[model samples]
Target: MTESLTIVRDDLTGAATRGLIAAHLAGMLANTPVESVHALDLTELQHPSVRVYSAWVGGEIAAVGAFKTFDTDRAELKSMRVADAFLGRGWGRAMLGHLEREARDAGIRSLWLETGSGPDFVAARRLYESAGFSYCPPFGDYSLDPLSVFMTRDLDPASESAGR
Candidate 1:
């Protein structure tokens, strides 16, 4: 099947975007405990530094991702999810690349993220690893927990070509 991908700064005030995120978070939190997904609701997704992106395929939302800036040179990946039908079809990779590019454009030199250390999150960990992230100590409000894992990748301008 042919799919078109576009990444844009999302405005959560829109009902469609809110519905998409709500459904994604609800699904993620359904099987896993609330603490596992740790996803932000619509209100929290509106933080000043968070830039959300939605991937649309033929006018339907295919996936979603966000970059939450923590400082001038650092940011965190949050709320990344691909619709069930689109998983494993390279949508996740495309979204990650888009977020990385957005971070670079914003002058961020590093990106970090936290994911659950459960079977449900294994694929996500592998995805981040394949995208150049390496295991790292927890950052921001996170602390080491048996149920959590943290990863980070440096976004050096000189290494941009090699990364791609």
Candidate 2:
């Protein structure tokens, strides 16, 4: 935590970023059913609607996070992962706040995310909850599933209480 983190928009071509994303996908597939694994692949992360960012502590990639826009008002948080070496260092919360600022600055009004519903995801669930992301029914292209947990938060300051 002593090192400063610099978060930048990523092109997704760097090996560190790709490796972390691969790990994120592997974790998802290993923890959840294939049908309930909603994490985006490399190709999907490069889509025009998706924007990925990487947080670095000097030469080391601390974490990676992304969001996929659904029109102008809403977006889905995607691909958030802290490198194994950076775990327990508050990188997850830092990346989450960074992505929230990016989305809000770009005029996104609400943010949604789908994460695993299991023991492997307890920490993730806690992070989202602490950030005011309340549980919600599946949104967008998602459907109800036992292994999936959907949560959302409103970006507008006036509706912040409602989001919680």
Candidate 3:
């Protein structure tokens, strides 16, 4: 079935978003060590610098993603997740594309993110790679760590909007 997906800027404090954020966090905790689990909790997701997005299909959350601004041109991709029911259905990719467009709209020149370096994160890593993100050194407050894999992409506002 072809369902139209709606993307919205989510206020992570609400009940609908809170549940999804918690589920994403729980999945992160279950798969990685406490120290290596970098997924933001509900409170952190409420930070002023972060902007969260959710993809809704048929009135249900199919996927979610967020980005945190850093300086004027950089941002960190955060809290990306696809609901259990939406896995293998390209919802994650759709959510990611939405986030990228948002970043481009905001004049963000570079986008970076950190993900787990384990077998469980293989698919996530591939998703980033396919979306034009390349390996990079950790940014923001992150330090050199064996458990984290960092990736980045540079966006040009002029090029992205030229065709549109």
Candidate 4:
């Protein structure tokens, strides 16, 4: 498909954008216990380390994703979701590419993420794996937990030999 989507920093002041994100998250966690999901709410998105992006297709919000820095050299992938209507239309992949670009721009050397091991998160885990993220020990405030699976991908552009 032609790349007709635009991904840019989210406009938190826009009610529609915020609503879309909240709806997506709510749908994603509808069946799981709140404690099992690690996604942040609107208030947490305002943190200094978090950079949120929204994807627009035909001027309508189609997807959203964020990168939250855990340290100078590391960041966590968070809140990645594409509206149901936009699924299989490449929005998720585009948003992911944008997050990686943002990570690189911020000089982040590694990207970490935590997703559930349940059926609800199967697609998410596959996406991360396809994007080159591999299983890793928990990082940041997270600890090893049977309910969670952590993954990480290193971004060392200077190391040309490193696989993308």
The global C-alpha lDDT for each of the candidates, from Candidate 1 onward, is 0.83, 0.91, 0.87, 0.83
> What TM-score does structure 3 among the candidates reach?
0.93
Q: Which parts of model 3 have CA positions greater than 4 angstroms off?
A: 160-164
Candidate 2 residue-wise lDDT at 101 = 82
Q: Each prediction's Cα RMSD?
A: 2.0, 2.8, 2.3, 2.5
Q: Which stretches of candidate 1 lie over 4 Å from their true place?
A: 159-164
- lDDT for residue 33 in candidate 2, whole number 0-100: 75
Candidate 4, lDDT over the whole model:
0.83
TM-score of 4: 0.91
Between which residue pairs do clashes occur in model 2?
none
lDDT for predicted candidate 3 compared with the true structure: 0.87
Q: Report the poorest 10 consecutive residues by lDDT, candidate 3.
A: 155-164
Q: What TM-score would every model get versus the actual structure?
A: 0.90, 0.94, 0.93, 0.91
Q: Score residue 47 of candidate 2 by CA lDDT.
A: 99
**For this target, which candidate reaches the highest lDDT against the unseen true structure?**
2
Candidate 2 vs candidate 3: the lDDT winner is 2
Q: What does the lDDT read for residue 62 in candidate 2? A: 92
Candidate 1: the clashing residue pairs are none
